[model samples]
Target: MQFRSIAMAIGMTALIGATLLAPVTAAEDVPPAPLPSQSLAPLVEKTAPSVVNIFAQKVIRNRSATRYLDGSAFWRLFRDTLLFGYGQDRFESSLGSGVIVAANGVVVTNYHVIEAASGILVALPGGQVYSARVLVSDQRTDLAVLQIEAGGAALPSIAFGDSDRLKAGDRVIAIGNPFGLGQTVTSGIVSATARTSFGVGDFRFFIQTDAAINPGNSGGALIAMDGTLVGINTAIFSTSGGSQGLGFAIPSNMARVMVDGAVKGQTLVRPWIGLSSRTVVPQIAELLGLSSLHGVLVTDVFKGGPADSAGLQPGDVILAIDEFPVDDPQALRYRIATRAAGSTVQLTLERDGEFHKIAVSLQLPPNEPARNESWMPNLSPLRGARVASLSPAFADEIGADSGISGVVVLEVRIGAGAYRLGLREGDIIRDIDGRPVRTVDDLLTFRTTPFKSSRITLERAGSVLTATRN
Candidate 1:
């Protein structure tokens, strides 16, 4: 009986050992926690739904007579008459990408994407498509805000990240419909920040990336690793029409301002400090006694303007804006333009080796030069041509030199005599028949006296052109 008791104790001990070691063996065989999934697939899956493909179409008129070269007078008249019959409207299509910025179906894309488009269509993933309407467009910044009818459906949207905080070498991904090949994703690092002078669009300021931005990539999303949008892919510097690792994007901060302004019914109204300055170079920096070639050397300041009123002198060098380093004049201009009017900005200036912080309120460009649309029925070419008085305000509005003053041709009616004579808009009529035409009244008064022929000396885009009509 004692031996039996000992055997029972051995069996119970063996069973306990087996039960405890079973779990240990199973744990060892379970294979490690999958290395935490280092891929960016999750982030991309979350953000790709917000990136949309845009297709735009417009009717373009083309003439068939232009294709035939025999220009006999008889044939010309016949061809011209036949031109109307042969002239057919061609459907032109453009494709680009856009980012959904709101749950209510607000999208932001490059202005050139939808410019002059009679119809716009936005396609989301899963074969859903919606008609898009352009809410607002800012040509100066080349950005357009679009609204899509969501049919009460909530669409996924991407959050805007701080582009100003982005630095070089930061990893970024771009999602777009490159070449209409459907949705594509590219990866690259931030090549540079504050890129300007690329001649890409109205706004020169850009964020440079090596990301593969191609034709259809315009208006696509450039997202950070966290899936927040940092920029809008706009242009790629390529000679062969392919990505060469040089792509440009509009900064997200600028886009945010545009979107906010658009949704509020006030499309973008860019505020300026009303001054002209040049980037201070190394030589200029040494002469100005600066430490480095960093700052904008104020060349001319508008009298009683924002900078002048803020105690900025002509020789002053702007070092920064609201503590952000101002490496060039364009940078300063962009910073002020992004802010709303009546908002005050702190400018850091250095004069005579001393730095001072000055606050200036942003203001709308003055509209002082009165715009006068005049039509002189008696004058053949001048008829139906719009003229406006040149003032600092008008000059600023039309993007002309504020220092120039005269009567500017604002618009010429299509197919009008003025259009035939090539008296295009932006041509400053300096003289009419040797009579000084400084204002719309001057041109109007001169046109009152009838003459068989007229001589007009005009300045167009800083070039002198004289047209004589007989």
Candidate 2:
């Protein structure tokens, strides 16, 4: 009995030990692994559903033949039917990419894509094609929405990621129809953000990436790793018509604004204060008693534009707009574009060593009647005023001061902010709040959305006119 009892105790102890150590053994098997910094697989898989191949065609009166505008016998006879094809010419056939934004077939693409398209065809990921109709386009934002007629057809859509939340070095994936190769995926990191000169549509803030974006990738999806759409692939920094690891996309934040406005045929009227601008330069700064050359310098103010109507003037330095800080021209543009027209905006600016607050309500750009010309200017950047540097001889002829150097106001758009400032052909813009203007690039770099009000100090006919757009 004693021997049997001892054997039973030993067996019970052994069983208890095994039970206690079993949990520990399982825990040791996993051991901890380092967290992953990035992944493109999820981005490609999830975002690809929203990207669609876009093909558009429009019947346009072919303008292949030339006719003199002087209206000669040959010109008048052929102008209507021969030079410009009367009815039979098919003027457009183009390919691009688009992202499905709605489960009911609402799609988003670059404005230029379907601006002139008489017919639009959208191809789904599984190789299904459907007809589309353009809802509306905001030229200022370069954003357009299309409506597909597949009511009962289940469509894959994308969710908008906060582009404002993206940072440099974040991993991103681009899926598009590059060179019309159907659906293609490329990977890269956000190299930079908010570059202005890419000129994709009318938007300014951008997510710059090293992704391999090529032609036909316009309006494609640029997404974060978790499949959130951060941007729309639009333009590339290529010299040879191929990807050079430098591409730009429209941030999804702006895309959302445009897409929302385009829904159900609503118009997107971007807020405008109405003024022409040039960048403040070292010379302009010194001439105007400014310590630093920063912010957009108002070169001209419209006579009745928001700036002119509100007492904002020429030569005022605009430092910030709507509480968003700005130092570059592009920054101002980003701030303005992110707002709706007729919205009230405030600026903080310095004038004569004192800061001022200017409140102004924005206006929509004036409408232009449709022209018969082929919609080829859909992507052109010279959509605004024509400008060049002012000549000393011209200044002297206009009785303007010789030291006031700036580009000439050769043309004032009828409804532009500058034209409303009573800006005519002869005004010599001397300085922008202690800064100087000299070149077109200087003007391009000039930003006004940051300032509370724009001030312009120009010399005209021996009198210095300081106009303020408040």
Best by TM-score: 1
| Model 1 steric clash pairs | 366-393
Computed on alpha carbons, the lDDT of every model, listed in order, comes to 0.83, 0.72
Error of 1 at 233 (Å): 0.5
Per-residue C-alpha lDDT of model 1 across residues 208-282, encoded as one tens digit per residue: 999899999999999998889999999999899999999999999999998888889884557768776778888
TM-score of 2: 0.64
Model 2, range 1-470, lDDT digits (tens) per residue? 99999999999999999998775556668878989755566557766877999999977764434433444455556756675634235567899999998888888888777767888999999888999998876555566788888867879999888887788999888999998777999988999876766755543667899989999999899988767888888788888999999999988978787777777456555545666555677898889887677777776665556777877777888888866666655566567666677788898877886778898887764322111111112121212344555543333233233223465555555655665655666565556656775645555555565546667676665456886656
Q: For each candidate, what TM-score against the reference? A: 0.75, 0.64
Tell me the TM-score of model 1. 0.75
